[model samples]
Target: MKKVEVIQDFPEVELVGRKLGPFKEGEEVEMRPWEASVLEERDFVRPVRDFSLTGVRKALIREEKSSRLEELPSSFYRTVSREVRRLREGGEVEKAEELEEAIESLVDFRIQKLARMIISSVDLGDIPAEEQVLANFLSQPLTVWEGSIGRVFEKNIDKEVGVHAKKVRRNI
Candidate 1:
């Protein structure tokens, strides 16, 4: 983030700095005239999109092939299990549902990706958010992992819970 110039008494700033017209370091730009200020090209701050994330990590995992996808759902489950255990151990069941939701989304992501149906798996209206936003960088087969392992991931996602298990296959 660039250093924010504090405009005195305004207590608010125009988005993209457009409303601050004809600014020189010490100029007092009138708020009313600032609304339509055209910013010079030099004043524009380019937005960054990290393209490495979605492609690299996904490719790395896919390179591991069936073994990786087979391991992934359990891995997600284990991670959630560990966190839930900690939360429950710390006596914070009040927030368990939130944690569960996060786990579901993650697992569902893998399931949908492997299923080659991410378009229908999640709400499309959700703009890509997170490190995985780089998914566009991936190739097709790498973008969507398939095989018996996908079925395994699908099966593992709803694995039956033992009497003392932390997870249960009860419908979401």
Candidate 2:
């Protein structure tokens, strides 16, 4: 297989009619399978905006989060959800511990929609209007249907669940 050269590259245009610049050499741009994503809401559209490092960082974060889930085996989700259901009505101590774990796992601005409902009583300070909109959006239920770190632990509660990767067998 030919290796895609490490270079700066992006789609030519954005949905908002913005054009991206030509990639410079020596920059690492992802050219792997499923490298690009498409958002189909209307007439053919793609996110092809020219952005600074922040834009790239957001894209990379989104990609990394997606990749993390995709690398897991099929049986991961059902197992975790079952465990969550079992632990859902756990005692105060267990609930507190799970809450701590959830909070610790949250990113800088990980605002769940349920949190917004509770936060609505607080006075809006000097936060920007745009950020407030995002907060509102985030207040929606986060129904993430995918493999997660907690799932791994829940699945192997009785025994050690080592690394998942295994050697591929050839039939030839």
Candidate 3:
């Protein structure tokens, strides 16, 4: 869900079998993301909270200064990606490039931190939902790897116990 402000007054609009609103010009309302996107494309609404390049820059700075992965809003990546695409579409190429670079750097930092967390089996306490999903995916392989190693260790232990028993029987 996203909050969007109506930009023009309109009667109830039926969309995809749902009736949306009798919106006034200044009205702010919560809508499904798809609904907001549709209205925004028609110039009927705009996002109430837009993520900006400055916010991304600040987040990158914070990530650089921290040892742990910095938490971000759940919509962070989605908004940033949309903003970058919007900039490119609007012919703000230089700004879009800069924003993309910052985002890549931030992602690199977080990936390193996530790798450490997965290796150490640490809790993903405050990461954004997107990163949490990624971490969950990556951790599945780690779980399998750990189980495989445990089986190898158990086999070696059994071999050692069998060797000891054979020596004991020969002595007896």
Indicate which candidate wins on TM-score.
3
* Candidate that beats the other on lDDT, 2 or 3, i.e. the better one: 3
Question: Candidate 1 vs candidate 2: which has greater TM-score?
Answer: 1
Q: Estimate each model's TM-score.
A: 0.25, 0.17, 0.60
Root mean square deviation (Cα) for candidate 3: 11.0
Model 2, span 1-172: residue lDDT tens: 1122223433355444544324344443433223233221321222333222333345335534651211222332343344445556564457545533542333232333224433453443433344356555654433221235345545554255344322332211
Model 2 stretches with alpha carbons more than 4 Å out: 1-70, 89-172
- Give a tens-digit lDDT track for model 1, residues 55-172: 2244334534532232232133344466667777888876565566555544455544544434334332322233134334333445355445565665666465444333543422
**Each prediction's whole-model lDDT (CA):** 0.41, 0.37, 0.85
Kindly indicate the candidate among 1 and 2 with the higher lDDT: 1
Considering TM-score, where higher is better, how would the candidates rank from best to worst?
Answer: 3, 1, 2
Error of 3 at 60 (Å): 1.5
Model 1 pairs whose backbones collide = 19-34
Predicted structure 2: lDDT: 0.37
Clashing pairs in model 2, backbone N/Cα/C closer than 3 A: 113-139, 113-140
Q: Evaluated with lDDT, which candidate comes out highest?
A: 3
